[model samples]
Target: MIACNFSFHYTSFKCEKNFGVFLAVITIDLTSISVTSAVISMAGKVMKKESLSIEGKQGEQVSLLIQNQIKKLLSLFENEPIQIKAVGVSVPGICYSKTGLVWAPNIPGWDNYPLLQDISYLLRGKNIRIKIDNNRTCCILGEHWQGAAKETKNAVYLAVGSGIGAGILIDGKILHGFNDAVGAIGWFAVDRTYKDAYSEKGCLESLASGKGIITRVKESLNIIDDYSGYFKDIKIQNLVIGDVFDAYKQKDPIAQKIIRESVELWGITAANIISAFNPEILIFGGGVFGPGIFFIDEIKSEAKKWAQPLSIDKVKFSPSQLGNNAGLFGAGHLALGRF
Candidate 1:
């Protein structure tokens, strides 16, 4: 048997015989409802893997897609020597731990969705346990388990995709407050003056997330009289993040101003999280961070403007090494360890 050594949350799995119990872990990362199922060996190898995409679906249709995905994955691995044991899902919004309900704004018709109940019903009598968590928490767990935060007990994962959220790790434990809503930093009051719009996703996220970035560009295009350079050719409806960043490289004034403002907001938000959690490292991930990675240094520099002086210097800020896979790995670890 191959010797396997790794840490699962707080527990360490270290032994040669541990390989005999290789478990199939299904990670349902529902940013847009995608499924990734991997059979992980005790030796830390991903023995088998499969993925499915269910874009453009919503509500009960999405639920049915997930059930089919699980059934397909299980059937595919039916002949394998190891048995599937547990399933862990990373949801986009708040996942009520006790109620097993979900609320993701990005996925329509999911207000107070009974996700856990639906999944459980589909897998009835399978003898497999299921666990659920917010995607932010899963991102940090994945980083802690196999990515950037490997040796750190305290860490924060700031995910800026279509929206913003955070996953905090304090003393090696993921912080899940009442209702698992600890990391809903998108609603954080980052601005002094409040607009009715701020109430939707908070001041910081409205100005800094991918959706925010597009909104800013649209707002700029609408108000600016000088329709020259990159802004001259782009249509509001057809605009993408790549268009704005591409313009930023060529020194477009609109892109520069928007990016600069977003950098400061990211910095301020980073400071807020650091002051609140006092984490040793802040790992940046999510789709927005794919392009925003360029601003990490500037964000840290800006954080010094408002962050608690004592804690700011002690923290290190970096981009996530695991990229899109952070939540998947985290969900797998949650299945293997917590379930």
Candidate 2:
């Protein structure tokens, strides 16, 4: 059985079966749950509405929160037999499947954490199994399961959000490098010679990520105000990439500059991926892609300038049809493949 705020799809099994599997490809929404008393108390005074940083103890608190969420999900299947086959989870980070360690920068303390073993221990004696994968690989798997990449054996899915990453599928298999960081493109440097005033080298994320857009805007305008204009308000603490797109639509000079630079960076990255991987299709996903679609033609147009002429001509680009559900679907596929 699979459940989410969006929908629930359940499968029935025979009573003779003593085991079953539960797969979840969902993003962890931390804000929706309440933190522990200690965390809440520590967060006092320093915790701003939009930006709240917690200390190390928060990791255990978050682990408890996740355990509860999983319990709640498991409770839904109470009516059925208690046996469970396996649970496959897709997260937003570099997952080491062999050791079941997950390194997610966004989630503190998750770095090199034994997520699978821990979760399995939590479900011990339940006659169930658990597995995990990164969101990028899951996204592409979801697309292939029922979305635009259904028939393609070799494809790439780019997820552009707070950070940018890619999922590469070649010859119908997910490619995970030795360290399981094959698709981590955020660190891909665009400028070989360019370095930050602070001495940081060329990170693709510095130029193409959502944070990158805001940073660029700040550099250009030298204004500390949050992003606010025609399309959106400055309610959020920092400006998101969407605001940049809104500004572009309204013809804001700063927004235009940011878009032009960001798009070019994306094009260059795409060209490099195309040349290296030679994927048949390139699918774009994530929140940033919402505004990115409006600039697809421009992205492609610029990509043609830098991409290998033949390589660029062979690849097809399109938006992700699965949207947010791609990860969930992919998790299900991963679970299914386990059998």
Candidate 3:
């Protein structure tokens, strides 16, 4: 069911008769969804754009999908004058951009995987630069390059998705700490008392993320002796975050309690980001934000209770304008090697 989000994924790219020589670059957002596309930043045009399902594919299998996209991209311009200057990739978790090693926990068998090496083998004789970076880094890059954080020297892309992460920018440059493990804010301890649930993912992520919300909701569901609320029609096994948000909308008791906690935690996390970075703005995006978008104001209100007073007043929190394509666009920006 994964569909191409890029609009240019149709028909062969027509060669321009007199558009002048254009240096081309392509980028792929390779997670569960394979979003790959070629963008000509110079000409403000795109070519042979596409995306496909990379679901359940990990390690070498995932790299193969990327290789095939590169091959097809080359075939599109077969005998044409343009050459792919670079191919940028967006990967999950930690990625050593120089070493090409990735640690995508969501994708099975990809812990410390040599993704760049695998993709490089496929590029062979083609002289093209491949830039690979973490998804969090790419998210901030995309927002800074084209979204709400555009032109801001210091900003944070606080992504509240299935899991929580942040992409930090300081002085117009991404703050990739030593070993590139900088923005792993999931481990931030917001709770003083320890809970068994926080042992696995971390306090914030275990209690606030979409998966976290579902976990708490499910736990509550299991504890009730006999209850038939908004999720009465849904099987506990089939429950999802959307259902929880739906129940929240209906003011379901359990859903309200769970979401209220999540919102407060999100606000606390946002405050931490603002206090630490004192960024010009904080942009929020990711899967959970679909319904969570409506709670931005509420999150901000909660943030006021914990955030640095001066910093909170100076900072603005907004939803990501780039939406799902932030990583894709960020990868494209990476292809240009601007930073």
Candidate 4:
């Protein structure tokens, strides 16, 4: 019993005896927190959509959720007579299109999971085609298709959430490196002081990501014996990234210090990206950007300090207008390319 939240107009569409002639597509943005799916018309309109929370669920369990969403989306069109033509899935991590194997470290038991195979089996005997891609790739595609970066030839989407990653577009195409592992910018070295902690998550992400910020605050709290600030009343274990930003607004010294360092790291990361790609625009997105959007000016100023002089001036910085919908809309755009 899935609730169908539809915001589509199909009055112009005529339904005859052969209602199956009506064509539509499906798009899904599969992330660590939730799974969202939408029915997209050929004209790129989202007809109907549904989202399910899947936190703490494993890979196999998520597969079931995906199945449920698809079935529910398809059932909604029975009255409308629209036939589902294709499906495009935006995955959280590296998605190898050829093999349909997804390596999502965020999802337990998702490493090297046969996602395409699973979906194919689900849609067996149906003529519908499926395309799976990395979420970062879909982020830029979503932006290029309908969001901030429309018609832009070269652009980059810096997604700073619990972790950090990028989606690079060069000459109007998504850059997929060997093994399709491009845009893994979390491992970038933005900090000069190397630490044993930075080995797995990378220096930039360890310091700048939401998890990184929360962890840094907690670690600092543990070491500092006497510090009274916004976080003083809140237990250290209960601290989250949002608390840091809230405290920053209150002008808490500890929060200011932590966020200031993160700003520097984010700027360094942006500078490095601009210097390397020389994109037309660099869009910042992810969970952090919900409040993180406020720091765009600071990041740009920081980027100007280190980015190539020629490229820095050319690149315009923006917060993601589409937000989480970027991946969903981008997945729809990618499906449109399939034909």
On a 0 to 100 scale, what is the lDDT of residue 205 in model 4? 82
Better of 1 and 3 by TM-score: 1
The predicted structure with the larger lDDT, 2 or 3, is: 3
Give a tens-digit lDDT track for model 1, residues 156-229. 99999878999988987778876668898988776788888887777777888888899989988888786787
lDDT of 2 by residue, 1-120 (tens): 322111223342223223443222222222211221110011011111111224344455666656665665556545543333445566667667556667777666766766666676
Winner on TM-score (1 vs 2): 1
Which 10-residue window of candidate 2 scores lowest in summed lDDT?
37-46
**C-alpha local distance difference test of each model:** 0.79, 0.64, 0.78, 0.83
TM-score of each: 0.91, 0.77, 0.89, 0.91
TM for candidate 3 is 0.89
**Candidate 4 Cα misplacement greater than 4 A, ranges:** 1-22
C-alpha RMSD between model 1 and the true structure: 4.4
Q: For residues 1-339, what per-residue lDDT tens digits would candidate 4 score against the true structure?
A: 010111111122222224346577789999988999999876667888888899889979998889888878877776776777667889888887456788888889999888878888888888776778888888998898788898688999999988899999898778887778899999998766899988877788888999899998888888878888788899878777788999999999878998998888889999999999999999999999988899999999999999999999999999898998999988877765521
Better of 1 and 4 by lDDT: 4
